[model samples]
Target chain A: MAMSVDLPALEQTAAPRAAAAARWSRYARPVLGLVLPVALALGWELVVALGYSNGRLVPPPSKVFETIVALAKSGELSRHILATLWRVGAGFALGVVAGTIMGAISGYWDFAKRLLDPTVQALRAIPSLAWVPLFVLWLGIFETSKVALIAVGVFFPIYLGVMGAILAVDRKIVEVGRVFRLSGPAMIRRILLPAVLPAYVVSLRVGLGLGWMFVVAAELIGASEGLGYLLLDGQQLGKPAQILAAIVIFAILGKLTDWLIEVAAAPLLRWQDAFGARGGQ
Target chain B: MLALKEVGKTYPNGVHALERFSAEISPGEIVAIIGGSGCGKSTLLRAIAGLDRASTGSVTLDNAPITSPHAEIGIIFQEPRLLPWLSVADNIGFGLADLPAEVRRERIAAALARVGLADKAVAWPRELSGGQAQRVAIARALVPQPEVLLLDEPFSALDAFTRRDLQDHLLDLWADTRPTLILVTHDVDEAVVLADRVLVMRPRPGRLFEEITINLARPRDRKSELFDTFKRRVLTALDRSLDRSVRDVTDKSSAGEAMWW
Candidate 1:
């Protein structure tokens, strides 16, 4: 009787403990990813503190942090971050709109595909940076040229992704739309849109990455108020720590934006049956 | 009533998929189109569903020419073909978009219950098994109460036990509204189990070869001798349609029975 009572009591207590463990593990998994970077930073800091060298040319993480803090105190960090963010946002929006329209046309209509695809493919083959000179000449070296340059960088990937996704949509699923006698707009809304969304999200992520890349190039070409400008200024003034600080800021911003996109799309894509969604088993 | 008058299809590259095939099916009747590969069985079903045009003939439903997909007809393909983004309930309610939200919800609930998937209403298609997904597909097609339902080997991808279970489930659902069902299949047992009439077609310019009427009553027993007899007859017709020799037919028939049973 005593053993039975103790066994039931032990079981009761273990249940909530197991539940708490699971909950903790869920939060702990993401934190595990930060361990490597934190370890590397600490290791480098220890080396510098022990007088491994003067820590010049390739400054320690502490020096980079100090540079970042100084920029923040001067309000230069916010100005640069905002400038870069605005250019990317405007360019991404413009590129998405233009790419979506053109892709829809090319994918949905055979006539448009036959007429336009070859030319577009040929144009895509041209190195994107090769258009920098022409864009600067046409729009002048102001925000307009920078945004346009970023937009061009963002366009080709989105266009390819959308078109390929639309073309690859299962014909059998489209037949379901036809069987229901859905109107043209209804077919697009109900069927085409949802079907292409997964690929579209991937393309958006790729396009955003390119937007960041082109923004750096755009800012390098005679811009005064952006992270890329900070990079150029640091290089010319021989402030390697500031350059590292700017580079570090870029990495953080890029990762944060990409995570935002992923989090935003997670709910929409909860229905996906892909291998990645299953957490690789 | 649905009628096909000398329906034919010839591809642009000069291959004749179907040639002057014709049939008339009254409402509430279950008709099966069975043939060997390339016999245009699926092509006929597609034409009837108005997914593809009959190049040289006409398809009429209730005397209205069906040049494109019609509101009265719905189709279930070989695969479930459920929209991966939609929940089971949402997929069932997809065709009912024009109905008021209350009515749509009621119908979807009723459909989910009917397909024995009431608990899976919130589940995604990917989360369901093959048979469950196909059941959802059936619910999606039937929820709108289409007058004619076209099934293109809807259960071929399933295991035998699941296939039989779904076939019975389908028949039970059919007894509700008694919509006209035109099925395309390669399975002799399946053809006999569900269809009131079986139309066999020959390939190499597919055309109707024979029509075999199944006189067996409903709640069919798969192991019954009469069912075996009908299965044998359909199998023989299939062999003939494929132009197999008589010796090859006997040899293959026994092998098929061994596999199917």
Candidate 2:
């Protein structure tokens, strides 16, 4: 009887502590991730300050930040950022539209799959950079060529993901669709779309990453005013600080865009019982 | 009434899964098809559901031929097969897309309550336990109130306790709509408990071996002597359906083991 009385009190005390710990951990997670990078940056800064070596080649984090600040103030940063953003946006839209259509066609029809899959697979095998020259020659060294290059890079993964996802849809679930006597469009809208969405989000992220990569390659070849152009300009001028700043900006932008996709997709995929849902917890 | 006349299924690989199977089932009658493995019990059920086309003969429900899936037919498989993206409420409402929103909502609420999952409306399919998921599936199938509900060993994947519970729950729900039920299973106990008539089939180009009418009234006691008798008869029929030489070898081996013991 005494133990039972104590149990309620124990539970009452433990619940608040558990809630506090959960609240603390939520804030601590992102802070914990920042630890190593912050430590490394501070260590390097101290090393340079102590006159151990001249930080000419690598430069400290402060110098990179100063360069970024200077660029941002000059309005050049916004121009470059906008140019890169536009290219990626345009390329991604084109790639996604083409990929989804082709993927659906091949996935839905065996005859189309038999006719088209081999060619797409073979095209996918070709290194994306190899197409750079051909794209440049055909479309010229304008935004068209750059966007086309990025689109090519983005297309393969999205196509493969959509097609594979469609193919991988459980036959049993499709049978459920059939049992309802769903019309063709109703089946696609209700069943096929939701079934492929998780993989579609993953492929979109992958395609976006490739779009970033190919944008750099596209800007490296020719043209002006992008983050890639910044890299080339910094390289030619031997401005290591500028180059590092461009690299930092690239990392931040890439992560931000990917997070955007993840955030947008989270509500849609709330029903997923995947391992990743638990994450590190 | 649902009628099957000389229904046969031959696979492209030259395997005859079902051969000249025929039956006429009246509305609201619960029929169980039972056999050993590879007996095409599922094939026959699938054909009736219109998921698969019979290579020969025809299946007609209420004088209309069933070449493809009909709106009047609903099916439950061994697995729940719930769409992972939809909530329990939405999954139940899946077949009722053609209905008005208010009607759909009321019906879904009703179905949810019937299945005893009123609290799990917003829950995901993955969040539910196996039994709960199957219950949701039953609710989904019954929401549209299909004229014929085909079950392909729906309870076989569940544990004995859960299976028995679901079997009872299924009957309770069946009483509501009185839809013609055609169930396929290997479990004699299940067949005895739920089926009004048990049709036993022979393997290797599966054909009807025997039809046993279960005359027992509703709320049938599982442990009753009559239940055991029905079970024994079905088991004996199943044993006979197998090859005689194989049965002899197994019997002799079992007898040898018995002697050793």
Candidate 3:
């Protein structure tokens, strides 16, 4: 993107100018990653320029931009983003707490792992969307049901990741704890907890993504206040602009939340640098 | 004093790993148990460490029958099992639950310092070289100042030089604090170099074969004349034990007082 800006021509014979030109030339393909997106966006504008697609199937960026403005004016965009964010944060938190406890059981105790694994696997087979009716049936058509739905959706993936991380911990380390004569709780806290954290964190990130997705899906079906519900209401009211506005908000919030987690996790992962396995740069 | 009184172990699969094996380990003795792959050397160590229960007999530390893992016993397995996440200091401090926070920190620092890893107190296990990781493992085991230390071939994964160095390190640790050390190894030289007495075992339906005392001097240099003689004796005992396994296809009762020492 930087290289795309054409510099004013300076000299034809100077060595510095020639060097700058060479660098600019070399950067053309390396900068192609950013250029491709711009090109596609441009090409999308051309489609709108030609009118080969309708606003329904492919709303022009300009129209979507306008929808964003209208939603911002109404304060609806921020509301939806805040609502979705809260649900994902809550759901992700619940899922992590449950997943860690259960994951440790699956990792360390053969008896508990054998007993719980079958039930967990069975529950995981049910998709989050498929559970809408069941959640509503169990908890009624309210925020509780939607939150539960999103939590249920996030729980399994994180649980899977946590269990895998715990399982992936070196058997030798566990044995080391034993040789150190560590008691059960001390071993878990000192040895197992840190050892499995990397995996557990990765699972949480994945769960956050899945949880956000489920939050949107759950809101779409029966929500009255969530971003997904806003989009659905816009659809019912025959307002594509509102729907487009809702989508843009969703995209921004998703990117923002994921980025925030990564930023937050960076400090925790600095131990990576002590090992020099990852500079975490 | 530690003793295995008529110790017998049969795996769930019906493999007779040990049979009526009995031995007394007087205080501060370094005893090596040598056997082929399936020979219950590890099982004997596990029983002593109280990691596993012997089916028909009891292990005793000064006449107290072993029931479960106790702080008085430490066992180093074949692998260096350092937790990847914990720093070297924390790993060395892993089992020191009763220590006050300040005391724990001091002990952890001392252990890491002893292992020459004071500079790497905050380094993760993954940051360490193989030998360094194993040394930390040894440090973790030694930190507890256990009454008995069971080492199940704790240096087999290293190159010969590293193994020899660790053997020296093990001897130094034992010498400094004379914990009842029971080392299990398949390497004849390793057994001869480290042990005051080597117990040989036969494979498959494993039974103790013979007991040979190694009377070489301190740090028992492998290049020394005594080392070769001792290594030959352990190897011969191992070979004869393998032969005894073959002969056991016919004579099961012959594995008698050979184990009772």
lDDT (tens digit, per residue) of candidate 2 on A100-199 = 8898888889899999999999999999999988998999999999999999989998999889999999888988999998889998999999999999
Residue pairs whose backbone atoms clash in candidate 1: none
What local lDDT does model 3 show for residue B164? 86
Which of the two candidates, 1 or 3, achieves a greater TM-score against the reference?
Answer: 1
TM-score of each: 0.91, 0.93, 0.82
Q: Grade the docking of candidate 1.
A: acceptable
Q: What is the TM-score of chain B alone in each candidate?
A: 0.93, 0.93, 0.92
Runs in model 3 deviating more than 4 A are A1-35, A42-63, A90-120, A134-140, A162-172, A222-224, A233-242, A263-281, B245-261
Task: Assess candidate 1 and give its lDDT.
Answer: 0.89
What RMSD, rounded to one decimal, does every model reach? Answer: 6.0, 5.8, 8.0
**Compared with the true structure, what per-residue lDDT tens digits does model 1 show for residues B86-141?**
99999999999999999999999999999999998998887788999999999999
| Candidate 3 residue lDDT tens string, A1-281 | 12223565553347587777667766774587679767876787788778877667567777878888877789877787777778877877888788777877787778888999999999898766888888889989887888888888788877788788888877766766665566788877877787777777778778888888888888887766878988899889887867877887777788788888878876666565345332121
Which residue pairs show backbone clashes in model 2? none
Q: In model 3, what are the clashing residue pairs, if there are any? A: A172-B81, A173-B81
Q: Number of the top candidate by DockQ?
A: 2
